[model samples]
Target: AERYKAANQRAVQLLEKCGTTQVEVDASGLLTYPIEKVDAGDQPDKKLKPLSVDEERFMRAFYEANVQEVCSAFEFPHKILATALQYFKRFYLQWLTCVYAACKIEENHVSAEEIGKGIKQDHHVILKYEMAVLQA
Candidate 1:
């Protein structure tokens, strides 16, 4: 509940000063679908058991740690950090490419070299994965 509230505040903040018609962060559509019909998410086998609450919490915490670490290294603003975290959690779950991909998604992309330096990783791997994603 608290996390949702925080996320809502951040979303509202992000929508500010943007020259769009959207005035508020409306999330009514997110709950319109029944869980049985949609919440399985990418799973082809609906018969597969769903994650327990503990498992879900653990997975979210694990990924969030990585998000924090990378965003901290980059010294990103609150918006970018939150946006990166959102992308990782909801869309692109690939930890290896989340940072660079998140930057690109937010329209504030940094150079691959800068991302490599920031994360202390070899730029070649970044290039390799980026190309793979682009090709796919």
Candidate 2:
């Protein structure tokens, strides 16, 4: 343990000497973003918009909870869970379809029928929604 610590210390010292330990300030504007304007989507002028930002967030959170529950029950891999969450946020898709899509994205390749049987859903629905999920 002592030798390991000494080796780590030497490595750190060498990093410092080479200026590799410097903390870089990200000056790229991409690192910064505008704060969300409060109730911006609640304005009356935007008639075509369905849900306001808060409403959408609430719905997304609810759906995400559902997805998490399903994923946990099925013991899915982390990548599938993450991708499902991304699909939830970006596409506002159904939790079942999101998981199905995430499985495809991660190359896990779970069949629609298997997922449907596991979840008590009709297999055809999964197949039907797969195209829509990928298109979005």
Candidate 3:
């Protein structure tokens, strides 16, 4: 319950500025969806995939660590950290790469590179495992 509240708050804060609905950047560094057109279903449609048990566990671990790193780097409140982490986990439950993409979309310009630098985590590893995480 507490985790949900935290996650909800962070998600709300992000949407307050970034707008509701999903937006993403493609591999070519082009933003695929515009916020103004979000309500119009201008974004590409993709099928929702279910996660395997192993994938769930890995995402849980990944989200927890990523949350700690992001909160520590930005000096955000514990609640915010908890919220962001929760958001990441929940998102990945439905979509794999969505967590990192959400972090970038919702938060203030969080890039994969910045995340790696802040957390001392390898960006290459994160990118490499993105597909595996999705498949898991």
Candidate 4:
């Protein structure tokens, strides 16, 4: 709950500072650039509304179900699926932290996919280091 509040607050701060959270997407629906700032006159007032408690709960449940669905679809081992879900949770926390920090420093924003790529790189680095240690 506190984490959610912090995340939301950070988002609010970014939106206020930049006037918008608009990220450009290419024809393939992939983010091609950093977040773009909207003119003050063009910004929408309700763009950064926080979700209600019910909405938050629904979204959490939806994500959990989706994780399970993806695991089932791929026939992933239970242990691997559990690890993936744990990583998913941590990834969002790190992502929100990064977004807030970046916005403060550079007024830049990143798409979720970009954040995921970064997290994936970190995951690979950690795994490689761990394997090296085991082999030593």
Q: Name model 3 segments beyond 4 Å from true.
A: 1-66, 76-83, 91-99, 128-136
Clashes of each: 0, 0, 2, 0
- Sort order, lDDT high to low: 2, 1, 3, 4
lDDT (Cα, tens digit) per residue for candidate 2, span 42-115: 44463233344456557877989988988888899988999999887776655788898898899988888898
TM-score of 3: 0.35
In order of appearance, the predictions have TM-scores of 0.46, 0.58, 0.35, 0.46
lDDT of each: 0.58, 0.68, 0.51, 0.46
lDDT of 1: 0.58
TM-score preference between candidates 2 and 4, better one: 2
The residue-level lDDT of candidate 3 at 125 comes to 42
Off by over 4 Å in 1: 1-53, 122-136
Error of 1 at 11 (Å): 29
Cα miss at 100, model 1 (Å)? 1.5
Model 3 agreement with the true structure over 27-104: per-residue lDDT tens digits = 443445454333222343532233444565676787677567666766655655555566555545322234454454
Q: How well is each residue in 1-136 modelled by candidate 4, as lDDT tens digits?
A: 8887777678667656666555443333354447665644464664556565557667766766666664465454566456545544544322223232333233233343443364343333222222222222
